[model samples]
Target: MTATTADSVLTARAVLLDMDGTLVNSDAVVERCWRRWADRHGLDFDEVIKVVHGRQGYASMAVLLPERPMAENYAENREMLAAETADMEGVVPIPGAPAFMAALAGLRLPHALVTSADVPLSTGRMAAAGLGLPDVRVTAESVGASKPDPEGFLKGAAELGFDPADCLVFEDSEAGILAGRAAGMRVVGVGARAAALGPTVHVDDLTGVRIADAGGGEFRLTFG
Candidate 1:
């Protein structure tokens, strides 16, 4: 991984993006749901929130409740997914996300959404955020393991027909950044949460980014 600097240029043949904190600001809903879960289990929401981002609900549960049975986590995760999908309150796109997506469309770069969110949850959240879904997606159901395992990002790169080294990832959470690195892709950390995670580059938001076609199946990302 490269140092996290505001000014940098990265070239890649494909792009993989994380949702939630990266493209969408769903923290309000995330905190609300996780707070309830934390309370129910007599855990601290503060610590739980730190582990919840960039991972599937069951994965987060496993980390928070290491001694709990996997079966129990899976069951609760299902319920949590349904509840989160049904609730769209406070879901909104990150600043400049709309323009960023539009820019990608204009450039026609190969890109995919590689998110820990299941199909329904991802779909609902993106809709609530008013962002168009990328044609290729690697959702929670698409892989056996979650973020920090590199499964989803690797799958996304494969589906896009690009090698991991040829892809660039945009992520916000520590788990997502680690997964991108594990997949051998350069990462552009998206928010304040991502600053200390050692992404190839860090930006305050999409507003600080500029994407341009660099010809020959490659795209250039300029961060400021």
Candidate 2:
């Protein structure tokens, strides 16, 4: 549901953020990469794009090519990662992402990045977006399963020394929202598509989101 003024003050001990569509604006690169992959594999680009967001490359590949061996999926994922890192053509920070991160730092609140991208790809995209890396990051290699499984978000909360219930997750895709919910955290959808996923709170973007000192290791999220 969309955030109302009455629901703006959300209290949490930590924040969990998704990297791609949530923070880094890599839509162009992501679509380009996936489209090329789909074309080469004889899959419908439109259909492939639908399930690729908020999922690990390997996981998405497995869905697209269910009959492929695990080893082949891994190999293809590595190649995709390399391609993504090498091409930073349209990467940039999403609106309000910089300010939201700044608020997190300013409040001295704990936060972790939970992403489906592996280390190299995540780092490259973040760098291209001009976003600083968080203290704790949960990438594809860090968890046994990707989003829609809750493993990554659970891992992120654990690494941040916070209970899942005490963390607020910010996500931009349906899979991520489901994962956050499964992790027992309140989720704030960060985009229109995410909003459609029925997160606890939804915002068009991070533009007016701010952190307020709530004292005693807790902070209030002021959603604009």
Q: Residue 92 of candidate 2: its Cα lDDT? A: 89
Q: Tell me how many residue pairs clash in candidate 1.
A: 0
Task: List clashing residue pairs in candidate 1.
Answer: none
| Candidate 2 Cα lDDT to native | 0.88
Q: Write the per-residue lDDT of candidate 2 for residues 162-192, one digit (tens) a residue.
A: 8889999999998899999999999988987
Give Cα distance to truth, residue 92, candidate 1, Å: 0.6
Per-residue lDDT tens digits for candidate 1, residues 81-189, read 9989989999999999999999988899889999999999999999999999999999999999988999999999999999999999999999999999999998989
Clashing pairs in model 2? none
lDDT of 1 at 84: 94
The CA lDDT at 206 in model 1 is 94
Give the whole-model CA lDDT for all candidates, comma-separated.
Answer: 0.92, 0.88
Estimate the TM-score of every prediction. Answer: 0.96, 0.95
- Model 2: lDDT of residue 105: 84
Clashes of 2: 0
Best by TM-score: 1
